[model samples]
Target: MSAILESADIDRALKRISHEIIERNHGLESVVLLGIPTRGAFLATRLAQILKSLGNEVPVGTLDITMHRDDLRLRPPRPLLSTLLPPGGIEGKHVVLVDDVLFSGRTIRAALDALGELGRPKTVQLAVLVDRGHRELPIRADYVGKNLPTSSNESVKVSLLEVDGHDSVEITGAR
Candidate 1:
């Protein structure tokens, strides 16, 4: 375990995110939540629950952009990718894209491509738990839980309760 965010702190962070999202949009109507693969999916689910509790009938789903990633060959081959297209798709809908961390913004780029194949969305806003500040693309999240300053040699690991049995973020040095 590295010295980083604790489980309780993460829970609080997510709760803050949920609140901010609702506040920024001024109520979730005709809203849709779409997530990147892995942790993004978990975050989206939680946000959906929060919206539902607030009486917002927002739609939620997951997106897998494994093949669409720009670093496809740079990283290990990721088979068994999931390309889930929403039931009604995103045509003219307000879609909120969720991801665990915002790094080079390449992942969001790939997600946009994958989203394009499904349908056109009226608006697509990004929501991330952490923004580590070193973007390579022209993208910035509309909603961010935390702005964590980090070095290029560092790595960020976000653990969620739904899968990791804990909610926290770990920053580790590249070894």
Candidate 2:
């Protein structure tokens, strides 16, 4: 069986996360939102907008961890990947990494490695639209839109208005 959350719910979740970020950071300055590409990129932009609405000036960036992934040699190769470093290196700034879903945590590991190549940041935290558990690494999101307790055989799919023409989160069995 599959479950869905309406667009309104999604927006509320994002706004909550944004508020949490601002509160935890004691306000925003020299902060960056870097998405993990694909769905994460869209979510990152949305988060940036929310922060901006809250009167915070923050820069958003994108990252491609395809090559830095440990499973790169095992999984199908991804092409046209871009690992553009932030115009301003992460040093002395707070960086919040964004992703659509949190699963085995391997993706976060890869993204961390990719970030190292770019530049060091004063701090790095995670923000995910959905957290499905079953982490294989010691990682946790600082701000999560939703905590979805799901099975290993299932997956959380997040569709954003910018990329999917809709806004919602769905859970379905893995094919």
Candidate 3:
């Protein structure tokens, strides 16, 4: 495996992304962040910290898409994580879906389905740490930390400090 992003690099990318999000929205007003469970939640918290530093107090939530995935029957049933939203919920708010990596776009699709059931947001944006192209769906991330053109055989792994005890991204060769 080859290390593609170190801790500092990931931080820098997230900082940049936070700024972009703030800039695009013209401010943090009426904005909410929902992270796809696991690493995405970590990233959302990190981004929230950066946004706080920027003087924008935005709400962050966790979205668990386990039941919304297309291949649900392909695997055995497992425990589902909690899907927590802010106090007011996503009603007419600008919701930003955050994730560690964007690969097949299936996860984001599942997230979209999951989001729809919660509440109808004014707009839904996607933010990903890495955008490794090989899209099975037409989904795309609005803000990408690093656009690493990787082969379909290779796998990109993102390790976050919140869960993995470290923040780094590595590319592992095909099995």
The 0-to-1 C-alpha lDDT of every candidate, in the order given, reads 0.84, 0.86, 0.93
Q: Please identify which of the two predictions, 1 or 2, would achieve the higher TM-score against the true structure.
A: 2
Error of 3 at 116 (Å): 0.7
For the record, the alpha-carbon RMSD of candidate 1 to the native fold, in angstroms, is: 1.7
Best by lDDT: 3
Where does candidate 1 have its weakest 10-residue lDDT segment? 80-89
Ranking by lDDT: 3, 2, 1
What C-alpha lDDT, on a 0 to 100 scale, does residue 84 get in candidate 1? 62
lDDT of 1 by residue, 13-125 (tens): 77787777788777876678998878998888888887777677677899888868877788788784555656777899888999999999999999999888888898899
lDDT of 3 by residue, 66-101 (tens): 989899898899689868998979999999999999
Native-to-model Cα distance after best TM-score fit, residue 110 in candidate 1, in Å? 0.5
Q: Please, what is the TM-score per model? A: 0.91, 0.94, 0.98
Error of 1 at 75 (Å): 4.2
Residues 64-120, model 2: lDDT tens digits: 988777876886777846555567768878999999999999999999998888888
Q: For candidate 2, which ten residues in a row score worst on lDDT?
A: 80-89
Which ranges in model 2 have alpha carbons more than 4 Å from their true place? none
